[model samples]
Structures are given as C-alpha cells and as structure tokens.
Target: MQLIIFKDYNALSQQAANEIISLVKHKPDAVLCLPSGSTPLLTCQLLVQKAKAENVDFSSCTFIGLDEWVGIPPDNEGSCAFFFRNEVFKHLHFSASHIHLFNALSENLAQECAAMDSVIFENGGIDLMLVGVGMNGHIGFNEPGISFDLYSHIAPLDETTTAVGQKYFKEATELSQGITLGLKHLLESKKVLLLANGNKKAAIIQKALEGEITNALPASIIRQHSNSIVMIDEEAAVMLT
Candidate 1:
C-alpha cells in the first residue's frame, strides 16, 4: 500500500483526485467505482473540476456505487441515491445513463445483484474504486469477522455502523441493512484508493496503516493490495509516523 499524507482533508483529497485524473487521462472511459460519505466529497469536487478545467471527457466513463442503504426509497433525500445524484453526478454532469447503482428496492433484488456482478465482469472489471475507511476500519460495511473474499451480498449493519450512518438517516432504527459490493469486488478493481481524514479518523488510520493484517481492522487488508493507495490528511496521519 502507498501512503500519502497531506496538510488537511481537502489537500489529501486533491492529491487523490490528481492520481485519478492521471489515470483518466490515460483512459478516459475508465470504469470508476465511487464511494459515498464525507471523505470522498472533496475528491469528487476536484475530479469534476479536472474534467471541466482540463476539458477531460467523462462521457464514456461509467460509475458503480460502492454500496446503498437498504429499505430507503430512491427519492428519499437521505438515500445513497441522493448523495450520488447531488454530490457526484450532478456536479460532474455525467450522464445518468452510464451510472449504475444497486437498488435494494428492486422486486428481483437477487437478479439485480447477479446482473451487476455479470456486467462488471463483462466490462473488464473495475479500473479503480475510491473508498473511505470507516472509523472502525470497516470497508464498504464489511464490518468485522467477514472474510474479504466474499462477493456481493446484503450486509446487516453493526450497531456502530448504523449509528455512524445515522448522520445521514433520521432514525438509527431505520438503518439496519446495507447492500454493499463485497470486499472481493473491491479487491477486484485494478486499483484501489482509500481516503481518510480529520482528527476523528486518526486512531483508525494509524491502526490501519501501522497495525497488523488482521480481520479486527478490516481496512488493513488493503495492505495486501498491490495497487492500493491510502491517502490521509495531517490529523489522520498523526500517529502513522
């Protein structure tokens, strides 16, 4: 894993964006696996700016959402659907047609999951997947105890995950399950970019980078990824030496 520490969250994100832009320049139609939550917001902004200022084309690009909270209607303001439409796609002005998201509400959710995995495989797999390390080191809500080799599945959110996600939800009880592309899918990407920022993440970031490769800290599994890049802000990198 490659680590890059920056002065602040925004700087860390910009550096990550530049790395992605470098890849995009080489392959404009790259399939980018995007994540949600606070850490990636600035990175997305920088990415869209790169597309605009440099006239980088996103028309041929495709986006796959990392995960979605179960049971929320697509129209709900608090949904992951809402975050993608507002924070990433709308700002970047990418065609809604090329964006793919897993809807937990589909009548045949089973079929949808199977189709998504098939489509990704047919498309030469994902080029890069942007990820945010949860405070507990959970990656894509895989939580603790789950094997990283498991593919796509519906994950029952742990109490900590549900509570942390409540920052976006109205009620903690309303947040239970999440439809996440499994750790296997994340590792399948040609490259992985994991971002962490702020004082809140300092402990986990340090542990993830400096600690052992064990299931107790799921993000540490990225240590095994040949192309994984762990980007962090100053505060988050504090204990990493």
Candidate 2:
C-alpha cells in the first residue's frame, strides 16, 4: 500500500489520471474497474482530456463498473451505469463492446453475479481498479461487516451510504441493495488506485490507510493488498500525521 496527499482535488485528479494513462499506454487492452460519484468525476474528466491531448489510444481498453444500485433501470439517472455512461464512457475513445457493467436489474440476481464474475475471470482479472472511499469507509457497496472473502455478490446498503447517495437521484430514491464486485475482486487486482477528496472524508481516510486492517472498514482492507495506492487531497488527508 502507498499513500499520496496532494495540495487539492485538481492535483489529486491529475496525478491519478497520469497513473491510469500510464497503464493504458503500456497495455491498451488493460481491464479497469471504475467507480461513480463526485469524488472520481473530476479524475475521469481529466483522464479524458489528457488522453485526447496525448492522442492516447483507448480503443482496446476494457472498462468494468465497480458497483450499481439494485432494481434501478440502466438508463435511470441514479443508476451507476447511467453515471458511467455519461461521465466516463462518453468521454473515452473505447469500443462500446469493451464496456462491461453489472446488471442491477437482472431478474435472476445470482445469475447476474455469476455472469459478471465470469467476465472478470475471462478477462485475466482486473489490471487496474480505480476506487473511491465512502464517508463511512465503505468501498464499492461492500459496506461495514461485509466478508472480504466474497466475490461478486449482492450487498445491502449501509444507512450512511443510502443517505449520502440520495444526492445522485433526480428526486426521492430508496436504495436498499447493491450489486458489486466484492472486496476480494478489488484486492485481487494487479494494481489499485483509491482516491478521496474533501474534508468530510478526512477522518475515515485516516482510519482506512493508517489504522488496522479489518472488514468493518472495508477500505481498510486495501492495506492487505501488495499493489494499492491511495491518493487524497490535503483536506481529506488532514487527519493523517
């Protein structure tokens, strides 16, 4: 595990983008795990701008969504798929066929999980997984108390997550469950890039990176991975020594 505290969000996003751009440059077909939410929005934008400026090729890179709210339509504004489509995919020069995302509306949820798991398995596993730590230390929807041994599975959303996530919806939305690539999948990645911004994330960021490894704080488990990097703005890094 490695830690990098930047002066502000832009700097953090730039650094993160550079790292990802480097990966795609070296391996255009690299499989990437991406996240939604405001924290990573700027980073994805920067990645697009940089890739365009450098004429970096992303036509062969594969993108995999990390999680999605269950029961939501893929086209719904609140769905992770919609968020990524508008935020990341629309900005990339990648092939549409290479974009893999969890099916939150799958009638047979178990089959959905199995299918996504198989996709990851067939892709030779994720080469780079970009993540964002939630205010409660949750990673993807693997909330506190989630088993680290699990693979792609359904997760019940934490209260804190539901409340914090409400802002994404156009109106009132109740998200009770989520479909996510389990912590095991994230930990198994060849490289992990986790980002956090804002002073509101300061305390949890400190705990996740500097505190003990435990499932109770899902992001803390990143400490167990051999190739994980954490990037945070100074505000988010305020609690760190």
Candidate 3:
C-alpha cells in the first residue's frame, strides 16, 4: 500500500486530480473506475475544468462506475448513476458508448452481474480505479462480513452504510440494497487511488490503519493491493502513521 499524506483535503484532492489528468493526457484510452461521493466530486469537477482549459482529449477514455444502489433508477439523484452523470460525464467529452453503469434496478440482477463481469473481462480490466473510503471502512458498498475475497457479486450492506447514504435520498427507505464491485474485481485494476477526507472519516481511517485485518473493515483489504495509492488529509491521516 502506498500512502500519501497531504496538508489538507483540497490539496490532496487536487494532487490526485493532477495525477489522473496526466494519465488521461498520456493515455486517453485508459479505462477509469470512478467513485461517486463528496470526496471525489471536487476532484472530478477540477479534472473537467482542467480538460476544458488545456483542451485535453478524453474522447477515447472509458468510465466505469464502481457500484450502484439497488432498485434506484438511473435518473434518481440518490443513485450512483445520477451522481456520475451529473458530476463527471455531463462535464467531460468522453464517448457515450465508453461510459458504463450497472443497472441495479434490473429485474434480472443475476444477468446484469454476469454482463458487467464479462464487460470488465473483455476490456482487459480497469486501468485506473478511483475510490472513496466510507465511514465504516467500506469501499464500493462491499460491506465487511463473509466476503474477504470476492468478485463482482451481490453482498449485503451494513446498516451504518445505508444510514449514512441516506443523505442522498429523500426518504429513509430509499436507502437499502447496493450493488458493488467485489474485492477481487477492485484488485484487478492496474492502479488504484483511494481517497479519504473530513473529520467524519477520521475514526474509520484510523481503524483501517491501526486495527487488525478483518472482514469487518473492507477498506483495510487495500493494504494487500499491489499498487494501491491512499491519499488523505491531515485529519484523516492523523492515525495512519
């Protein structure tokens, strides 16, 4: 695991965005596994601005969402699909066919999972993965428990995750099932960037750093990732080193 401690969250996010921009500039065809959350929102916006100002080309880039909320429509603002579209896609010039999002509301969830898995395989896996750590140390909704080494499959979510995710939903019941890329799929990425920001994430970040490796904290599994880069602010990195 490669850890990068920054002076503050903004600087950390900017640095991350800079690196992503460099990658895209050099390899516009790279597939990027994106995350949907406040932590990556600013970074995405900055990247779009940078692209616009410098005339960077992203026409060949492919954007793949890491996860989506089950039963939530793509138009639902609370869904990851909506988040990615409004926050990143609409702002960039990426090819529409290159952008991929899993239909969590599909009646045939099994088929959707298989199709996503095949798509990832056919694309030769993700080249760059952008991720955010949850307050419960969760990544891509792979809530800790009974799943230490998993692929793109269904897994139950922890109550804490749903509760925290409710901020996007207008109703509490709207926060329930989540479809996430398994730990195995995440580890397949050639390069991984995990961001953690705010005091709200301090405890979980510390737990991921100090606590023993266990299924209870899925984010901790990144420690075993071959080329994972973890960036955090002073508050989030307080207990990391």
Candidate 4:
C-alpha cells in the first residue's frame, strides 16, 4: 500500500477527483466500485465538476455501489443509491444500464449478492475501487472479523457502524445489516483508493496503515493489495508513525 497525505481536506478531495478523472480519461469503460457517506461527498462533487468542465465522458463507465443498508429503498435519502444519484450519477448522466447497485429491498438478498458478484466477474473485475474507512476500520460494511475471502455478501453491521450510519438520515433509522462487496473484491481490483479525512479518523488511519494485517481491522487488509493507495488529509494522517 502507498500513502499520500495532503495538506487539507480540499487538497485530498482534489487529488482523489483527479485520480478518478485520469482513470476515466485513459479507460472510458473502467468499472468502478465507489462508497457513499460524508467522507466521499466532496470527492464526488469535485469529480462531477471536473468531468463536466473538461468534457470527461462517464456514460461509458460502469459503476458499482459498494454497499447499502438492508431494507432501505434506493430512493430513500439515506440509501447509498440515493447518495450516488444525488451526488454523482444524475449530474454525470451515467447510463442506467451501466450502473449496478444492491437492491436492499429484494426478497432474495442472496440472489442480490450473486448478481453483484456476476457483474463484477463479467466486467473483468473492478478497474478501480474507492472506499472510506469507518471508525472501527471497516471497509464497505465488512466489519471487524469479516472474512477477507468472501465476495459480495450480506454483513451484520458492527455497533460502531450502526451508530455512525445514522448521520446519513434526517431522523433515527434502525440499521443492522448491509449488503456489500466484500474485501475479496477490493483485493482483486486493479486499483484501490482508500480515502479518509478529519482528525476523527486519525487514529484509525494510523492503525490501518501501521497495524498488523488482520480481520479485526478490515482496512488493514489493504496492505496485502498489490496496488492500493491510502490518501488522507494531514489531520487524518496525524497519528501515523
């Protein structure tokens, strides 16, 4: 894994946006797995702006959502699908056919997992995966103790995840499970970009970078990936040794 620390959040977001734009420019059809939530909001916004200003065509790229809360509708404000639609997809005019996201409302969630795995496989695996680390060091919803060998699966959300996830909604929403692409997919991706910011993330960022590679800290598994980059702002990198 490689680490890149920026002076501040804006610089980190700009660099992240630039990396994504450069990938799309070089490989218009690049398959991407992206995360939702506050950490990536600025990056997604910058991406939309730069793509529009520079005439970056994203209609050809295929997008895969990293995870979604179980039982949430795609249109719900707190859903990962909604986050992408409002922040990136609608603005970029991404083709519906090129987008693959979890249907958290599906009766057969196992089938949903299978479908996601199929899409990733058919697309020759993910070209790039952008993820954010949770306070407990989870990636996607792959909480502590989740097996790194698994692919797309339903995960039991960690208590920390359940608590932190509430910030996405306007009111209290019970969040217990998540359908997510597993760490296996992240490991197999051609490139993985892990983004973090704010002093709140400093200690976990340090652990994810310097701690031992173990399922107890899912983000630590990124160390095993041949081409993974950990990009964070100075505040988030403060605790790094």
Error of 1 at 79 (Å): 1.4
TM-score of 4: 0.99
For model 4 the local lDDT of residue 6 reads 95
Query: lDDT tens digits, residues 1-241, model 4?
Result: 8989999989999999999999999999999889999999999999999999999999999999999999999878999999999999889988999999999999999999999999999999999999999999999999999999999999999999999999989899999999999999999999999999999999998888898989999999999998999999999988888
Can you write out model 2's per-residue Cα lDDT over 1-241, one digit (the tens) per residue? 8888899999999998999899999998999899998988898999999998998898898888999999999898888899898888877857988888888878988898898899899999999999999888999999999999999899999999999999989998989999999998987999999999999999999898888889889999888889999998889988898
Which residue pairs collide in model 1, if any? none
Which runs in model 2 stand beyond 4 Å of their true positions? none
**Candidate 2 local Cα displacement, residue 73, angstroms:** 1.1
What is the overall TM-score of model 3 with all chains considered together?
Answer: 0.95
| lDDT string, candidate 3, 93-180, tens digits | 7799888888997898777778888878888898888899887788898887747667676657788888888888777655667777
CA lDDT, candidate 2, residue 218: 94
lDDT, residue 146, model 2: 93
TM value for model 2: 0.97
TM-score of each: 0.94, 0.97, 0.95, 0.99
On lDDT, who's better, 2 or 3?
Answer: 2
Candidate 2: residue 209 Cα off by (Å): 1.9
lDDT of 4 at 124: 97
lDDT (Cα, tens digit) per residue for candidate 1, span 169-188: 66544888888788888778
Best by TM-score: 4
Q: Which stretches of candidate 1 lie over 4 Å from their true place?
A: 170-173
Winning candidate number (lDDT) = 4
Clashing residue pairs, candidate 2? none
Better candidate number, 1 or 4, judged by TM-score = 4
